[model samples]
Target: MTINLTLRQLELFTATMREGSFTQAAEKLRISQPALSTAIRKIEVELGLTLFDRTTRSVQPTPDGRHLFAVAEDLLRDFKVSMQGVAERASGLHGRLTLAVLPSVAASILPRALMQLQRKYPGIDVAIRDVMHERAVAMVADGLADFAVTTRIAETAALAYDEIGADRIHLVCRDDHVLAKGKGALPWSALEGHAYVAMAGSTSVRRLADAVLLQADFALQPRFEVEQIASCIALVSAGLGVTALPALTFSMFASDRLTMRPLTGPTISRQIGFLQLKGRQLSAPAVALAGEIRGAYGKR
Candidate 1:
């Protein structure tokens, strides 16, 4: 009969042959002697070979058993080395970590955080993607990203978030614009006549912005509406229109022509948070990266 003996059973045979007794093999395997005997019997039955020449005084390998021992030794050696490699990789703090962040932060906050992360986990390959919050959350859910940094989460089913920081919205305008002259506590009514560059009407941030204006009894004064915050910043810098964005967005500003004033009377803001799939456990490397994210924002 063809043998279906497992690598385990074969190892038991090898161990017993080396020790010359089931008791000695059991000691090496840290199992009882009867368990070792059962394993060897099962292996012999499957292979239809009397691998061990049983005698009252001692046990010895038959001629065919000696040949099988050579192969079994190599098999166990390769198996151990394979497991060692996996253990080394798992324990080593190296590999790729793909992260998703809002487009505004991609232009502003994330670069600084990435620089700090590179210092600690130097070998990690980091892939940063500029994505919308909805897409960012989905990216993690769909296994496209290891983490998502977002200002808000619309739905909680596929995602969970931990507050990393609080980012406040600031009203932005070109330096030459009329409202740019206004200082402390700009009134909500002041937004009525100014041309504004708002995010696309579809976004949650845009909805928050609209809600702020609505509560103030004013409609959005839009000269243009864009899909991305960087575009909104670009348009604002060009003096096309003004927009309100998180304070972190200001960090992206390299131009001297655009400036921000904190919106007052009613504050419009969203909290910055790290997101992951709700019920999934993070891999070792992902967990390590997440610790850095938490530490970075927690210290701030």
Candidate 2:
């Protein structure tokens, strides 16, 4: 038969056994002696066995009770260990932090940051999801991600943001591209009539690029458009067309395939940062990871 033992019964029974009397167990349990007796009685009934050799003078365990007591002792010991394990995991930094990051940031920046985080908080778990900027921001807002790092911060009811760092926008072109071969900074007028490869649409990067070109009195000259940043980087790598990008991104990845030159029209920069749901407190893992991300720039 299956039996369900209440924790109170086990505690009472164990205390009484160790104390050698129900009276002492009641004191330890802070209950009336009758209440402690009732608890032991119920436990005995559930097991369908007499637990004690009892009379007026003293109480002693029967063979079955002794066998069960040993088992209960082991069980209680294991239960305490299990509780400690849980406490250590929750109270100690040993759980997963779900992270969402824009595709570009995930490739180079996130990995570097994570390596540093692991060194400091080895117990923390990091579950990283790489997504488009819009989806990444939405993930944090919707509780799907504990934190998100991105270049584009979308203001919504869901997210609160902090500035982690910023990078200047650069004109990235194939190493063979004329601008790549020689440049201190690039003027927008130099590309007044040149074809460009740009982000597909609606992305903050594409919008920023458009605004920059627009103010320079030149309309965007798009030869191709794509959604993924990696694709945009790949386009330039393959010598398709030039595009403006965060300087650190190309600097970290892409060997000689592409070269980044400072975009010198006006102020060309993008702030990179972390975002989370409004009023959401970061977990230990997320906090540790955020610290590592901040440390990546070192003094920024």
Candidate 3:
């Protein structure tokens, strides 16, 4: 048979047992003695067992009632602990956040943001997946990550992009390269015949560069193509060839060996932001971390 016992009933039963007097229990619970007595009767009826042995001026819990009281007390204690944990998580004081971020932002902006998040919410833990832009988007879309920090590669309704900032495209080359001697922003046409170190065709950086070069009616060809940003920086630093990269990714380059100039004559920049499933709300910790990331990027 199913026992339909509410927590309120358990509370009343336990209180009556502890106080050992119906009148005193009612006073402690802030209820009328009659109301408390009626509730006790309901519990006994529900369980089909006599919970108390009572006489004039005396009340005592029966063996069965004592056993139920022990179980109920433990359950109430555990419930209280569970609710406290829930409250902490809701406040973003204790929880885990998972983010899929581009390698560039992951290396540059994310470290400072995570440090800020840790200082503000020490109980929060974070997991980071540093991947390319397309993979970062896929991770968020597939529910493999809470959110993503990357460039908006395409327009789509499935994902909502909240732009935190933008990174301008820059031409990166060794400090001794002929182009490095020029001042101010350089026109896209100026890259004409230089040996280009192109990022892999699959990368967002390559796509942006290709689009800009195509629009400028420039036909520069790659002498070296590399997939990783570090490799591109290494090649450029070694004077193998110059590469175009966004300002944020320039953090990976060795400053003493390389220099970057902003591209002009229709300057190009990529929107950097959070990528998440459209219409879904982020968890409290995710929102807090996103704020930290925005602040870190803004400071840069």
Candidate 4:
């Protein structure tokens, strides 16, 4: 038979059985005896089972009541444990956290932040996607990721961004390249007549570099154009040409023989930020991860 039952009724039944009297169970549950008896009556009527033998002086459990009491005790115990797990997850004690990040930030900034997150919240499993700036924001806006680390998006009105850091454009070349011999910051004009390994025009890193160079009526004369910062760095390390990129991009080439010189003459930098949907509330783990990222930036 399909018998509809409520947890409150089961709790009352089990308590009455344990205490052996309606007066005692009512006191234990902090309810009036009449109210407890009414709730038990409703459950007994619904199940068509006489769960208790009542008398003027005392109460005793029926045979069926003895069996159901055991079941109810176990069910309530398991239910309480399940609810505790849910509560813990809601408070950031356990869960999954996913982030979409720009390639540079993924390589440079996120590692430290993730380490901090793991130490503080060990029960959280992390997933990260290294992508271009535009795609990172797109992932947040599409709900494919909990948050993103990327350059500030100018036209993404549906996404909210909080500035976390900024990375200056640097002229990166092989250590033995002639430009690396200079002592101070390199001027944009120094790039004149130099073969440049450029990133795709759509990238925020390329856009920032080009904007600063254009202020001096200069444009990157590309000898090799690639889509990713890693590719640009690879070409530069191979002595194909020099490239201008954010200092954060240097993290990916940690073992490469590269020298980065700060660029001047209308100095430029890209503002990095955390992006999330404008109106959505982040889960506890995501908020914790965001705080860790900000802390990592401060430390860096």
Output the number of the lDDT-best candidate: 3
* Candidate numbers, best lDDT first, in rank order: 3, 4, 2, 1
Where does model 2 exceed 4 Å of error?
Answer: 1-80, 152-155, 251-253, 297-300
| Cα lDDT tens digits for candidate 2, 136-217 | 8878877899998887565667678888777787788878888777758878676655668888776767877887877887
Quick one: RMSD of model 1? 6.3
Candidate 1 lDDT, 193-253, residue by residue in tens:
7788888876767877888888888787688989877688888888787788777666666
Residue-level lDDT for 168 in candidate 1 = 71
- Choose 1 or 3, whichever is better by lDDT: 3
lDDT of 4 at 43: 87
* lDDT by residue (tens digit), candidate 4, 56-131: 9878889999999999999999999999989989988789978998888878888999898898889888888888
Q: Is candidate 1 or candidate 2 better by TM-score?
A: 2
lDDT at 61, model 1: 87
TM-score of each: 0.67, 0.70, 0.76, 0.76
What is the Cα root-mean-square deviation between model 2 and the actual structure? 5.7
Q: Model 3, range 200-271, lDDT digits (tens) per residue?
A: 999988998989988887777999999999898888888888888999886765688788999987799998
Candidate 1 Cα outliers beyond 4 Å, as residue runs:
1-88, 298-300
